[model samples]
Target: MNHQHDHSYKLLFSEPRVVRDLLTGFVKEEWIDRLDLESLEKVSSTFVTDDLRDREGDVIWRVRFGDDWVYVYLLIEFQSTVDPFMALRIMTYVGLLYQELVKQKKLTSNNKLPPVLPIVLYNGERRWNAALNVSSLVQSVPGGLEHYRPDLPYLLLDEGAIVASEQWSIETQNVVSAIFRLEHHRNLQDAIDLIGLLVHWLQAPEQTRLRRHFALWVRRILLPSWVPENEGAEWQPLNDLNEVHNMLSERAKQWPDRWKQEGIEAGRQEGIEAGRQEGIEAGRQEGRRETARNMLERTSMDDQTIADLAELDVEQIRQLRDELQSRP
Candidate 1:
């Protein structure tokens, strides 16, 4: 299946209501109070690197903060593996964004750059162990070079750490928190409970838009995992919180059997991917051996030259030549 998580996340936060909830509910109140959430504007994530390569998937916003304008740099870290150099990568992106702003004449007469609040929204299965700041990856240097090391750190919103709690603001903010909570659920029952709670929070009549958006997201990206066989057609017509609860409760009866099948299928996919990689490596090695043999038979190049050209070890090249000589 083609995973659409990158697009799903971008769409989720694209709503100004969702972004406002994120900043006001999850972020510190002091930072929230400074910004005018009403003026939060979605900016283009497409940016050209120094090498002129275009990069995408990250979300950004330009908002008015008090009397000044600031940028929000949101990096969506959805890959399975953790990147140890994430801090340095964010630094480069921030620098490039500032350069773009300057090129567009968005800077002040003194050439002062706008303040950026960098945030990472990571949802990988494994816990994040990478250093939080680029300075942490830098080797300690003398006073002369001390200023060269960067010390910026991005705020991390790890889904693994999120839980549904009273601390979250009510209504849409609570629903967003529940969405993150669903990611860390231990079993189908827990997941169902969280989904039910999310629907319940959206029961307010004024929250029709939020409910529609959340339900669409759940159906598009999340339902397949919960009900594997028919792609959850039964739950597609969900209209209210009560309907969500009833559907989930009914599916709970077959969860045990369906869950086992899904687990087996997941393992089978992993094995297939591993075997594909191994076959590619084996093919590459065999091709190199054939190249070494051809060079030995048809060319005047020595073993070292053949080895260098074919990317084979000198010893392997010699062995292949010996095997060829012994064959009639």
Candidate 2:
């Protein structure tokens, strides 16, 4: 995982509202209805294991469930690769958390440990194939030894996988859903639209802090990734959600042309690799057509402007536009 991405996610999850919406929107369970989201509070993520080694969690929160507190151990996994032993890791972290609580005398009235809901939020492109329960990682033994095996299971929210499965909707009003949409947006237009929605949804006076966190994430992470380095270097850090939306809306007009130029350059490279004049011409024409198609699908630019930018004939752009309109 990128350090900046990890830190930005931690920043977002630091807000109680983000964590509340995260659980309410994504973690579908009947018990979620009983959670007192208003009672959600951030807790210390640092812990000392029995071995005297220090360990830190990504984010930790505790919320009221009836008369007891349910510890939410949120582990953010942003790497491209999946951790095979993640179940074991969750077991270790939860144990450390229990140990810390015991030392602090934070147990229940019965002097028993509180129940921890271990959750792993993964944003990797690959699907998670790890065991969700620690018992799965341990081999079963005969003579009833299997009864002694650990059975801790953590809830896994695989963002990319969920998006691919289309289980979540982008139209949902939840902040966490909006964040997921922005993270896995199909195109620049999708991101711009979602940012506009975020600006509108977070307009309340009390939501100012959460709004600024989104703005910072967009300014430092999303925009730099979407915009070309030369163009993005000229951009100043956005101060608020409104500024971020305005910046993206204003720069969106220029992106089609930039993408068209990039397509042409990529075509030239492909032609050079093919080492044939016919291949060069074919590659350039196909590139222009593809760029024109992208413009038609991703933007509302007029056919003439798209043709001018893609260096294609207006008739070709019009045909592409018709094809797009005809699609179901």
Candidate 3:
């Protein structure tokens, strides 16, 4: 699930190609009918910027189109737990993008930039009734009658309009349903088939890599929280979770190594001469080597980079990595 996308945002914006396709149908025909591929901006995933120090935007994407070059700012944010300050959050990026467009000079002096579309895709399973806003948090009003309004619009992904669209393909439907399932599923295994199916659909280099990346990330974070102990006799879903239940077992064998490698390098640096000479050194190196071996077995990560991230010395990483090459 290593990707250049922000998962929450990707889940919010990309999976509904059904809607985007419907929305952009006009653009596909009228605007981008003959442009070179590179000039045209597109993605089935979310891209983000930190927008730190002064303020943060964490914007997913902004694509400019045509001689008019109207910018399309696709903003999506995900809420796993809960927070109420989201309106201010959206404004932060919407403003940053406006600032950038002015700096780029791509925007005309007289013309306004395209509208910023901020969509919030929430999956915490909490009953979110109130819209998130900064003014509400502050609670300001005239002393007399109390007239205050926070101008913010939210397109909830949890709502049926986005998730249950008939225009979505079967695989897209499975992934959308699976992600929403995290709000209700008893544990990670409760939704493994959909997880695996999403991996199948989105893992390919081109198909829907971004959507897949976010889906797996959401799955991983939810994986440890719960698992079904009841063993219901008829645990039937619209689909079956047990069908790809084995992937969870396989992934279990693999991901620890990824973690081990990441931790090993950190441990190596922190280890003093004593920590290294004591039994810790053996455990650190072994932890990393085994991790590299395990990750290589399951994923397509490059060997050297994996070593660096895992904090393994090049040789140990390579050695463990090389053994995987000779495997069946």
Candidate 4:
């Protein structure tokens, strides 16, 4: 995972609206409707372990569920490869979070730990095949020992798979969905269109912070990855959403023509190479036929023998022999 992408994702999810939309849009459990999204608040993800070591999570938020609170642990997995032990890692983090909550006396009124919804947000190209529960990674013990096994499952939201799913609609106007659409865009024009939508959707004064985060993500992460290095150097820093939209719109006018020209040149080169190969093959076949003809006319070899020597088929050798006999 690129560090810049990690930082950008963290910054985006830090906003309460993003977190709210993430759960509302992706998590499809019946209990999601019972929560109060208006009570969403960012929680400190840093925790001190028993060894006095400080560990920090990516993003954490707490929202009211009836009289209690549910902690949403957002773990952003940006690596291209899947982590097989991701379930164990989530278990460890959840335990640490519980310990911190106990220390801070943030438990429910009944003196119990609150529910923690562990979510893994993966952006890798490959589908996630890792075990969702920690118990799945452990070997089943003999007898009744299986009952003592630890169990912790996380909700996985794979960006590529989710966006490609039939259930996911591009018409969804959520900001997070817009981000995903931009990430999974087919071409430069598609990306430009999505960015334009984001510009319109977030134009309200209340969404200034989220809009700024989107602009920063485009400037720092998307632009460097999309534009060629030489051309990207000429692009000035994009401080606002409109700047990003304007720059992409202006540059996109030249892309279709350049892309078409490049494609034509590539096809021409491929045709030339293919023709060269065909000519070489034709020359080799002619040489073999000449050898077979010489053997048929100058020697008493049979069609099969001549064919074997010249690497030609017996039928072809016979045809050459017949043609030689008919010629004056």
Candidate 4 residues lying further than 4 Å off, grouped into runs, are 1-5, 51-53, 168-171, 233-236, 256-328
Give the per-residue lDDT of model 1 (tens digit) for 1-328.
1133546556777767677777776787476787887899998877897688876878889889766777888887778778899999998888888888878877754668888888888888677888888899999888789788889988878777565333544444454577676665555566667777766666777767666676666666665655545546678788554566677679666654443344344545555656887755665566566556555653334678668767779999889888986998
lDDT of 4 by residue, 117-174 (tens): 9999888878899999999999998999999999999999988887897364556778
**Considering TM-score, which of the candidate structures 2 and 4 is the better prediction for this target?**
2
* Higher-TM-score candidate of 1 and 2: 2
TM-score for each of the candidates = 0.67, 0.79, 0.44, 0.76
Question: How large is the C-alpha RMSD of every model relative to the true structure?
Answer: 16.4, 7.2, 16.1, 16.2
lDDT of 4 at 64: 99
Candidate 3 Cα lDDT to native: 0.47
- Displacement of residue 169 (Cα, Å) in model 1 is 7.8
Q: Show pairs that collide, candidate 3.
A: 187-226, 257-291, 261-310, 262-310, 265-311
- CA lDDT, every model vs. true structure: 0.70, 0.82, 0.47, 0.78
Candidate 2 structure quality by residue, lDDT tens digits, 1-328: 1223446667899998889888988888999999999999999999976677876637999999888898999998777788999999999999889989999998886789988999998887678999999999999999999999999999999887777775655466688878877787776777889899989888999999989989878777677555656776565666788888988898887887778887787788778888999889988988888788767655555678778889889999888878876999
Q: Could you give candidate 3's per-residue lDDT for residues 1-328 as a string of tens digits?
A: 2223344444434434423432343232454443332433442222234644443223234344444443344433344445566667666656666766656554654576655555555544454455555455556567843455446454445433334443534533444454554344433344554566655655555555455445345444443332222322222221222232454556544554545655566546545534656546766665566556545554444666567656677777677766765788
